[model samples]
Target chain A: MRVALFITCLADQFFAESGVHAVKLLRSLGVEVEFPARQTCCGQPAYNAGYWNEARSMAEHTLDVFQDAEYVVLPSGSCTTMLRAFYPELFRERSSKFKQAEDLAGRTFELAEFIVKVLGVTKLGDGLRGRKVAYHHGCHALRELGIKQEPLALLANAGAELVDWPASQECCGFGGLFSVKLPEVSLSMADQKISTLPRADYLTSALAGCLLHLSGRMQNHRVGLETTSPYGLSEVRPLASLLWQAVEGAA
Target chain B: MKASPNNYPEEAALVIREHPEVRASVTGATLNFDQNRRKAYSEIDTEAWRVWAEAVKNHLLTHLDGYLRQAEASLVANGVQVHWAEDAEAAQQILARLVRENQVRTVVKAKSMLSEELGVNPLLESLGARVFETDLGEYIIQLENEPPSHIVGPAIHKNLEEIRQVFHRHFGTALNETPEALAAVARKRLRDAFLRAEMGISGANFLAADTGTIALIENEGNIRLSTSTPRIHVALVGIEKLVPRFSDLAVFLSLTARAATGQRLGTFVSLIQGPRKPGEHDGPEQVHVILVDNGRTSVLADPEAWETLRCVRCGACLNACPVYRQTGGHAYGYVYSGPIGAVLAPGLLGLEAAKALPYASSLCGACFEACPVRIPIPKLLLAWRSRAVEQGMTPRFEAAAIRAYAFTMTHPLLYRLAARFIRYLPDQVLDNRVVPVVKAWTEGRAGLKPSPKSFRELWESGEAQ
Candidate 1:
């Protein structure tokens, strides 16, 4: 099976390993993953800020960049939501591109959903055996796309011990512009999520913004970011990167 | 504290920074309500009930004019005096006229957010009438002279200690601890008000056109006494509160309390058809139903926003919203706050008046889940945001920044070039917080640092294969 990798702007620019490992994982699964180089941001920031015309301009470019690909996958659920859930609404007035947006939306999938459902490869490796993992359920992925079991299934199959996190469904308050718009409230919300988290070996999420907001705050603006439970995990990375590490570590 | 929708970000920040106590109470109260709602929903098929309720409300909203007409005819047929108010002033004018005609001296009000929205207390007081709030929470806030800090729980921000203090000052009582003691004091005070009050006022939860019935669900018996004890019963209802038939109350009645305060049903579900008939021993002598529009029709005109009218004012959204949990209702600078207010404010008040409200939420989608009617609140927020942008109500600087982003995104080479530069940014710039967004983000969290290599750069070097 072949798929197009839409390396979201955040992952590509800030957390490149997620995209790198996304490709690595897909290739090891015997799936041909193509990185469409001309792709840029998913126009989510603009779309979310209510700048639809600007969003459409970027979305049109993205649509053209991956026009020939069979399926589109992304490491970020938030951007994936922008593509699959909102692009159609953005293009509703442009009858020609509306169908294209809907078409793209149909073939688009988040990394875990793509791996478990589309690729039918649930168990990547047992490298994560005995490793307690606390997965952050990004709001867009869990709600907009209805992705709950797919990522957890993949993590559990990799021999990761999935902990029961109370604030798993809570938002990390990295709501694109909301973080900057209401910084204090955003921090308080992150504090709420962090203070309630269960101790684990790693905290991961499909949406990179959650990681950016959460991992940043966890470290108190420094480097040695540990699990929110104080004496626990010492790493924060995207779900795709963690999955790739699980498989490659075994290899 | 005075706040306005135009300055939401600053107001929210002030609350978060200075008012730790407010944050604690807001968080505690809302979280408790959310827990109750979730537990209540878990016992039944929440999905089916929500879908059914949403469909029913959608029908009511779409055929609102017809339903209003039918309800008016039925209410009139039942010997009810029905009046129409096009705006707040008109509603206040109707009240003013009624008070004059009946020589209304003291008016007792059950908890009505709509009445608060219309600013009726001051209006009645200005017309030489003494107004009393009978609902416990409302009575406390009335004494405090504050707008409701919550949708359902008006005094939710006040701790028991604060309430006791308010009661101690007003009723000259000892600092009360027992709920029953405080309630007894309120009851004694309201009993005298009820005896002397010439008019009773309320807001309806649902109005059934078929039977010309007004349905209200309240845990406190205050609404009961307010509507029944006075000589004149006047209910100021929003035009959106219409149901097709009397039996349809079963669905709303089932979900309203469960969603609001998480009860199987409120203690008292008053279904008043009209004024007391001649044979009726103890009920109001005269009943008046004033259908108030007040920009609801303006909301109805919008194809997408007509769904805002589907709200049942359950306050479930307020309890579930994360932002509301942080800042409480006062920061929204509107009668309604949280997700419904975020959506409803811009529609009711013009966009310019409430420009900042649409952006108050993080679009977490909790409010939509909590809503019994399943109003697509996030979608409405986006719609309002889009309209705001289209009208150029958002900041010009942000608009320019987004345009620049869109430009660079469409032109990938510029994006790649910017990517290369961002990775190599000196620690000083990141630490110094040169950019405003970076400044905002790093206020509490760590500074952002881009990866050394862009994904496209790695892909171009043939590293993936």
Candidate 2:
């Protein structure tokens, strides 16, 4: 199936490699992925800050850019939720725009949900077998999209050891504007979430926004472990790429 | 008391820095309440019950004036004096007038957040009447001369040792009095307050219109004494507390008890219909019911915020909120706190008095999940935020930045150009220094840096498909 990649502005601008990995993973699984060049944002930041006029305009732009796509996938659950859940809300009083939003929202999915549910692929066997992975359940994905088991199911199928962290469902406090507005409380919440990290080798999340806040804070403290989007996890690579020695030996 | 929620940053910082125990206590208490609330509702359809509760409240609110009139007529017919208060000052004035008219030298109070909202105790004391709190937690805080940090457990922030000190200092009890000892001391001390007081003041948990009854739910029997022992009993109730029928109490009573303390029923559920009849010997001689608006009518006028008035004040949302778990109630610097405060304070106190409150939450939504009436607290918070922005309460720079960001997002050419421009900036310039708008964000975390290549550049490179 052909898909349009809704790489969130954060993932596109700061973590483009993850976007590349997402494309590679989708292709390896035999689904074609397209990036809509004109797509700017789903307007989450604006919507979150109560800038409805700006947010609606951004949504209108997004809907226009992705109008032709049969399916749209984004790595960030929050962005996906923003489009899928809030677009209709933004256009509530306007029937024509609301209908358009509803249509586009139906076609949108978070990357992991799209991969597992739409692509119908759970395991990418032996790519990064035996890596101890801890999943950071993004608040929107966990609570809004109800995306609890999909990422873990896919990771386990990919031959990774999944460990659970205490208060895993609690927010990492990177609540868009909330991170900047109430920085002290935001940092305190992040610290509480971070305290559970030592047990896992790498933290995985479906959304890159949480990773950005978490990794940024993790870096501030000089923590040893790194965070990755699920697509970038080594487990999804082909066997040849997974075994570095095999690629080198063949060369 | 501060007249504005603008001090939230400094206040939140202080609460976080000074009160580590507040976090631990609030988290523990809320988690326990959540767990128990779930278990307590195991036998029943909790969601369906919530729907019914919501419908009941909505129906009452829809015909609020009718129900209130019916209630007043019923109350007056039962020989209970009814007073209407348009605002907090008016409510206080009514109570002050009652105290003056009765020549009440001493008063005993049950735990009533409405009274807290009215600032009644201090007002009464200043009016030359001695007021003593009869609720155990309220008594503890009253002795310590501090506002309650938690609604139901007013002294949840205080440990047993702290209570012991307060009791020892005030009642001349032992320094290390146990919980039981502290309770005994409170019981003994308040016994006289209950008997000597010429009047009693209470906040009703629910005002049942069909029965013309005021229901008081308490674990302690203090409410019984406060409303019964004194010759004059006055109940201060928010107009939003009206329920249509006596039978409606079953759902509300269960939801309230479980949502609050996880009990299937509070130890005492006193429903007072009116003043005692001539043959009655043990109850109060006069009953006064003050139906308080105190900004509730304004809250009701905002359709988006009207559901906030549906809250039973069970403190469930506060207990479930992560922000409240961290900052406690005092940080909100108002009568209400947590998700309810975020929603209600803004609507009641206006954007200026509560603009910072709506921003205080991370929008975690645990409170919504925990609300008994299923008030969409997070959604209400967003509504308040929108109102705040409309009123220009946000910082000018922040508003400009958001508008600029929105403009860029809506304009593909500008967004693309900005994206390309940002990519060429050095990591140090982008990630090391805090920018003016996001300075608070980068304070305790690393700043964000743009990727070397945008995703559009990658997709166009045709390396994947």
Candidate 3:
């Protein structure tokens, strides 16, 4: 299946490494991956801030970009929710645009959900081992998408030891406009999550916005933990280098 | 004691800083309430019951006039005097007139949020009537000479030490008294006030239409005492509190009990049909029920916002809200607090007065999941936000920024150019705290560092493949 990467604006601008790792992980599993250059954003900021017209415009732009793709997968769970759940709400129910949006939403999946549920490839051949990790389940993914076990299943398959993190299901305070709009409550929420964060070598989640907020706060507080997405944790190599390792390991 | 709902950001910030110790108790209390509610819900099909509960509330809201008329007629038939008040001022006037006509010098009150909203205590006192709060939490707040912070747990924000201090200062009790001792003092004091007072006032949990019975749930028997001890028992009820049938009480009782305090049944669940019967020996002689609109009709007229009136006042949404959990009830600057407060206050007070309340949420949706009636709180918050924008209540800069963002996002080429342009901006200027408009975001967080290169730039340059 050809998977079009919906690298969220956050990933495209700041955390591009996670996107690079996502591509490698997919290609390693023998899946055709394509980058839709026109894809910019899922319009979460505008939509969430009550800017319906802006959100609709951005949503339409996204729909036009991924119109022909067989499967649209992205690393950000929050954006995926905006697409899969919120897009239909942006348009009238009986409108043709709403139908098309629903069709797109049906095929759209978060990276981990696409991997475990769709691709059916669980174990990644012992590439990740002996690592104590905590998966900070973003609120949108856990509450909105109902994705709890997929990421855990993937981590367990990769042979990573998952530690108990406090308030794992709570928001990391990266509520798009919320973080900036009400920074005190946002930081306090993030502080609450971090105070409960069990000591670990690595803390990861699928959404980069969370990782960005958490990693920034963790750095400020001098908490020692490598924060990244699941793809970034695999075997410590770029996709190109990982492809060579995959070939050599198969031999 | 003034509500700062208009300045939520500052008020929330102040609460976060000043009430540092409140965090643990609020967290512990809410978490406990949530867990107990979950367990209580496990005993039955909570989802199905919630759907039924929502339907019942929706039905009552749609046909409120009929149900309320039926309730008033049944109440009159049951020998309960019924009065109508169009708003808070009118309600206060009616209650004052009742007190004056009865020549009542002292009045005992049960936990009544309506009275609080009406600012009844001060009015009564000003009218030369001494009002004693009967509920332990209400009594404690009454002693403190402050507004009740929470609907159910009025004194939840106070620690034991503070309570001891308050009791010591006012009741001249020993400073080393335990909570049980404090409760005993309040109980003894209220018991005396309950007997001496000529009139009693209380809030109804639910007003049953068929029987004209007011169903009240409380752990402390203060409501019973307040309603029964005086010659005249007056119940202040929001018009929206009416349920169509006596049988509907079962579902609401279960939902409110489990949702409020995780109890399958309240310690005292009183369904008073009317005044004392001829055969009755101990109950009050004259029972009065006042149905106060107080902007409810305005709420009912709003197609989108009318759902705010479905609240059972169980305080479940307040306990489940993360913002309320953090700031407690006082920060809301209104009688109602938390997610429900955010929506309901605006509906009643209008967008301009309660504008900040709608923006106070993180939109986490915890309150929605925990609502027994499934009120869809997050959706209401969103709707309010849209209303705020449409009314042009947002700051000019904020409105302009959102429009600019929308413009940039729709045009991908512009979005890409902006994205590329943002990468080159220095970290110093990009710091959200120092930035004129984005300062709201960085007040509590360190600034973000933009990525060095756009993923599209890399993918197009053949490095991504």
Best by TM-score: 1
The residue pairs found clashing in candidate 3 are: A180-B441
DockQ metric for all predictions:
0.67, 0.55, 0.47
For candidate 2, please provide the TM-score of chain A on its own.
0.87
Candidate lDDT scores, in order, read 0.88, 0.81, 0.81
Chain B TM, cand. 2: 0.95
Misplaced by over 4 Å in model 1 are A221-234
Off by over 4 Å in 3: A221-251
| Number of the candidate with higher TM-score, 1 or 3 | 1
Docking class of 2: medium
Evaluation by DockQ, superior candidate among 2 and 3: 2
Model 1 C-alpha lDDT per residue in residues B1-465, reported as the tens digit of each score = 457777778788888778877878988898899999999888879999999988988888888889999999999999899999999999988989999999999999999999989999999989889999999999999998899988899999888888888888987778855778988999898999999999999999999998999999998898999999999999999999999989899879979999998888899999998998988898998999999999999999989888999899999999989888888888889899999998899899988999898888788888888999999999999999999999998889999999888999999899988888876778767755678878887777777777777778888887656
In the predicted model 2, the residue pairs found to clash are A13-B451, A128-A235
TM-score: model 2 vs. ground truth: 0.92
User: Please, what are the lDDT tens digits per residue for candidate 2 over residues B48-125?
Assistant: 988899999999998999999999998998899999999889998888899889999999999999999999988999
Q: lDDT at A231 for candidate 3?
A: 34
For all predictions in the order shown, the interface RMSD in Å is 1.9, 2.0, 2.4
lDDT of 3 by residue, A139-248 (tens): 77777779888877777666667787657777677778877777777766777677776656567787777777776665553333333332333222222222222222
